[model samples]
Target: MTQQNKIRICVAGATGWAASALCKAIIKTPDIELVAAISRSNAGKNLSEVLSLDTEKNIPIFATVEEALQVPSDVFFEYTSPVIAKHHILSALRAQRQVIVGTSGLTDEDYASIEAAAHDSGRGVLAVGNFAISVVLLNRFAEMAARYMPHWEIIDYASDKKVDSPSGSTLELVSRLAKVGQPITTIPIQDTKGYPETRGAAINHTQVHSVRLPGYIVSLEAIFGMESEKLILRHEAGSSAEPYVNGALLAIRKVQLVKGFRRGLDSVMD
Candidate 1:
């Protein structure tokens, strides 16, 4: 693309915590044009007003993704709530646009449909749980450790306000860990407080413990306990969403260069 014809980008869930942060970061990059912003609550408002950005940051906000599509865009960043994120992704795909999704809680059925749509549209779709660079590294390390340990589990942490348990992060972690080995059975049960369900859910045959509290942004740990010393590998998201911005932006800018559905933020990370 020439300097005059930079990539046109649309952001779904414009007013969200992450989307707002991404928009602020997008302002700094000249490689992309913020053509559309979607937020049901802030519909019809200027993007700046919706995100509480300065007047210098001029961008339009729309109520629906379809409305944003009225304009031309090369990529769409889908940050809508998890319940609706897949729908937004599918819609964007049907429009033959690449999508970078940060939302979680997608059902397996939605993934199947998304994979098919990506194949049919010949466009790229990238999704990840936590987009921070460190989280990507954590996943990478976990994958390596799995090759050696072969027996371990996952623990996902979030603020009490966070609703999803066994978060998308855990799913991503477990799925990627499966590339080496996601233990094919629940983590051994030693102490149960009269309720085995408190141990959280199981995915890919690995135990995933979800902890919700008011102390953190988001975090995940890969625990491998063998003979004596236990290995605890973790990635903690600090108090800001800035870390996710770069990863999402990189995926968005590269979406046009890829085809089919790609999973994980690590694809763009070292």
Candidate 2:
């Protein structure tokens, strides 16, 4: 995006944890503008109060997408829960706006629909499991290992009581690995006696062990083993939200540059 042509954006579910962080990121980016923000529970409240924004502009809130889409925006940041993401993203696309979807519940069917919409509208749809640049590089590393090792497994970690068994990051990584080939073997933890399902879920013809503990933001390690040698690639996210901000900005700037939907964080990346 050029300096003069600021990318106008609206962040849906504006009061949530990730959406609030996204709004703050948009606030500081010179190349982007928060044209609109919507949150039903926080309607009529100030972004400054909820997110501690220093700027003194009267930012109005809307109760729903129907209200928010009355005003147009260049791009829409869809950051609600999985239950609402599919409908919210489709709403933005129907409004003829580009999208940067950060929410996780999108299945393959949902993606196919978004793909059709993006192609028909001649806009871009960018979906990312995790936006950290180091995570992107870790995926690249896994892709590279697939070329030679062809024997890597993915393991992703999250907090306990998180309902999702396999993480979106792990699913995304294994999906990429699927583009390469089937792994050599599959290990089923259910066959073991201790902890039963404690070893985690499996995906893409490979073993993906899920770890849920209290103190982690998000972390993953890809393990490749063969001939008495092993390759490991790992990335850990700190609580600071700044790293993800740049990628979000990148998606907003680069959204209109593509013709259709993009599945991975690396697709629209330069």
Candidate 3:
């Protein structure tokens, strides 16, 4: 593709742990152009310098999404914290830019608002809780397992420093399984003999347990049980951010194909 025909993208957390890897990949990608970046600490600096890349492209960094939107980009990539993610996405839609969301911790209500904004603006918003292909398959497999098995629970594991509970992947899994069917609960939380909190939080009629530790990067497990047999499906992420780069790139490419909100990477994947 010619330089003028390339997909222009502005990434909100361009200097973050995962987004930095995506920014590097975007620079190397032939069909995508890194137009602008949003990083409060790295504002007024070039993205090439912040990422330490040997490229001649002059990608400016802005402290806010509103400032970055001034560069006339075609796509907005949100990888920042939950606190500002919704506001950034809405701002992007109002700015007439399609969006690909990589931030987690947004509730269903948050998505509803984004969906409405995208509809009014006639822009597409693809929100992915987890961008790893393995996690995508995990969600698909867990949905399939939910059809056969009636009892299941989710175990979410992440780094100790990560603030989000249950992880975004876990939330996505819960939402997916809810569409399949609500898991069978034999003992209601109210009827529990001991502390009801031990049963974990009930989200969308499914029990979810979150574990924050030092060793884990991000791991999700779905355990399904029927009378005598049990099936466990799990997806774990490594130390590197490479697993998410390709999936995110795909989202950036396909987000404009639709006019509303899409929830998963699998939504655009064949």
Candidate 4:
């Protein structure tokens, strides 16, 4: 594709572990262009310089999302922390740029506000908790199981360094299952004899347990049970960030096709 046909992108947290890999991919892709980046630590430097990417074009890096918005772009990729992810997304929408969100920890309240902003701005926002294809399949499969099975729970696993409990992928799964209906619990937490917390936290009316430890990148399990049978759907990610790059790229290309907010990669897969 020619330069005029390429999709311009500005990536927040461009120097982050996962975003950096995406930046490299963007530079190499024929139909996408990395126009600018946001990184407080590496601000005022070229993206190619910070990522050590060998490219002829000079991609400017800005310290703040406000500064990055001044540069013309088609999409703003939010890969920053939860504290500022919503703010950055709102700012991008207000700037009339489509958005692809990879940051986690946004609450339902946050999404409501984002949905309003996107509608007002007439732009689109695509939020994906985890961009791995297997995670997408897990979410779809879990939704189907929720319709047939009455009892279920979720287990979220991540590395110790990951601060978010009930990984974003698990939260997305919970949101999806909530549409089907709440899981049936034979014994309520309030009815438990003791140590009710051991049963796990209730999220969207489904019990969710989070485990943080070493030797795990990210993993999610949706367990469904009946009187004599049980079914488990699990998706695990490895150390590499490669799994997310393609999904993110697809979101960038398809986000403009939507007018408001959308969640999950599967929303655009079709």
Candidate 5:
């Protein structure tokens, strides 16, 4: 496609790990154009200088989403922190820009607000916690397993730098699983021993255990306790951010066809 026909993208958090990989991916993609790069810390610096792209061309970095949206784009990618993701996404939606959110700190209520904004503006938003296709399938299978085995717990592992406790993927998984059916409603919560905190946080009737430590990039496991056998569904990620690149690109492309809010990359997948 020609330059004018390419999908214009404005990336928030352009200097972060996932955004860094996404910027590189967009640089090589023929049908996408990097119109605006939003990074408060790297504001006024050239994208080539910050990301070290081979091209001598410089992409302007804006300090805020409001400033970045001034450039006009087809799609907005939210790769910023949880604190600012809702604001950035709402701004983009109110401006009638389709958005793909890669941020993980948002709650279900936050998404509900985003969905309402998108509905009012008649734009689209795709949000995913872990973008790898394997992770998506893992969440899908966990939902299926939740139906037959109603006694499952989710364990999410990530590096120390990860702010969210359960992680976005775990939250999504638990939310989906709860929809299949309430987990063993007959089991009484009062029967638990010791401190209640020992059992981990209860989300949508499922327990979610989070482990944050150094050396680990990211990992998620769904453990189902049964009478004679147990079923375990797990997904692990390496140090590099490459796993999320393809999924992010897919969301960017798919956002064009969708209206309102769609959660997970699996929603758009055939």
Candidate 6:
């Protein structure tokens, strides 16, 4: 492809684990150009310096998303925190740029607004909680099972430092599962006994439990119960961030062909 044909990409949270990995992938991909790296902490430094890549290419790092938008880019990749994910993505959409958001924590209402904005702006935003294909399949299968099974719960496992109670993947799974079936229990929360908190938060109609520990990288489990048997679907991730890279890249490429906000990596997988 010619220079003009390449996909120009800018990354928010360039210094983050997932964004840094994505930057390297963009650098190596022949069809994608890493145009800007946005990191407040390392704004003035070259991306190559911050990433410790051997390449001498001086990719300018911007401290803010507003500043980075001055340079044109086809896609804006977001790997930041939830605190700013909504603002960054909305800004990118208003700028008429396609976006891929890997950051989590936004509520369903936030996504509805984003979808409306994307529709008005005629841009696309693809957001996925866990980009690993396995997790995507796990979610899909659980959703399928939810059509038949009436009772299920989500268990999210992550490292202790993970701020979010239920990991993004678990939330995504629960949300999707909730859509397919009604809540298994009809009892009011006021009637529940002992520690109500132990029952976990309700997502859609399903209860989701979060477990954070030191050794765990991240894991999500969807447990379904029936009359005589129980079924469990789980996806676990190691310390490496490689699992997310491929799915994210796929979203970047697919977002160009989409309009409005889209959710789930499985949307593009098919």
Worst 10 residues of 2 by lDDT: 195-204
Q: Give the Cα lDDT of each candidate.
A: 0.80, 0.78, 0.93, 0.92, 0.88, 0.86
* Candidate 5 lDDT over residue span 137-245, tens digit each: 9988888888788778889999998887878888888878877976663456667766768778888888788999999888999998778888999999998899999
Between prediction 3 and prediction 6, the one with superior TM-score is 3
lDDT of 2: 0.78
RMSD of each: 2.4, 2.7, 0.7, 0.8, 1.3, 1.4
- Model 5 C-alpha RMSD vs. true structure (Å) is 1.3
| Per-residue accuracy of model 2 over 1-270 as CA lDDT, tens digit each | 675588878888877766777788777778887767888888877766677875676566787887788776788888777777788788888888888888765666778888888888777788887777898899888999988996777777877856665666676788888898887754445667777555555565777887889997678999998888999999888877777877777777887776688767789876
Candidate 3 has a TM-score of 0.99
Sorted on TM-score, best first, the list reads 3, 4, 5, 6, 1, 2
Residue-by-residue lDDT tens digits, candidate 4, 63-161: 889999999999999999988999899999989999998998888899999999999999899989999999999999988888898999999999999
Candidate 1 vs candidate 2: which has greater TM-score? Answer: 1
The per-residue C-alpha lDDT of model 1 at residue 70 equals 82
Instruction: Name the regions of candidate 6 deviating beyond 4 angstroms.
Output: 186-189
Residue 199 local lDDT, model 1:
66
Reference-based TM-score, model 4:
0.98
Candidate 1 residue pairs in backbone clash: 160-213
Return the clash pairs for model 4, or none.
none
lDDT of 3 by residue, 1-270 (tens): 888989999999999999999999988899998999999999999999889866887899999988999998999999999999999999999999999989999999999999999999999999899999999999998889899999999999999999989788888899999999889999888999978998999999999999999999999999999999999999989999999999999998888696898899999987
Worst 10 residues of 4 by lDDT: 163-172
Clashes of 6: 0
Regions of model 3 farther than 4 Å from truth = none
Better of 4 and 6 by lDDT: 4
Alpha-carbon error at 234 in model 6, in Å? 0.6
Score residue 101 of candidate 6 by CA lDDT: 83
The candidate with the higher lDDT, 3 or 4, is 3
Q: Which stretches of candidate 1 lie over 4 Å from their true place?
A: 1-3, 52-58, 184-194
lDDT of 6 by residue, 1-270 (tens): 898989998899988987888788878887888888889999888999889865788889998899999889999988888889899999999999998988877788988899999999998988899889999989889988888888888889888988877777877777787678775765665578988888888878788888989999899888988889989999989888899888888888888888877788888766
Query: Candidate order by lDDT, highest to lowest?
Result: 3, 4, 5, 6, 1, 2
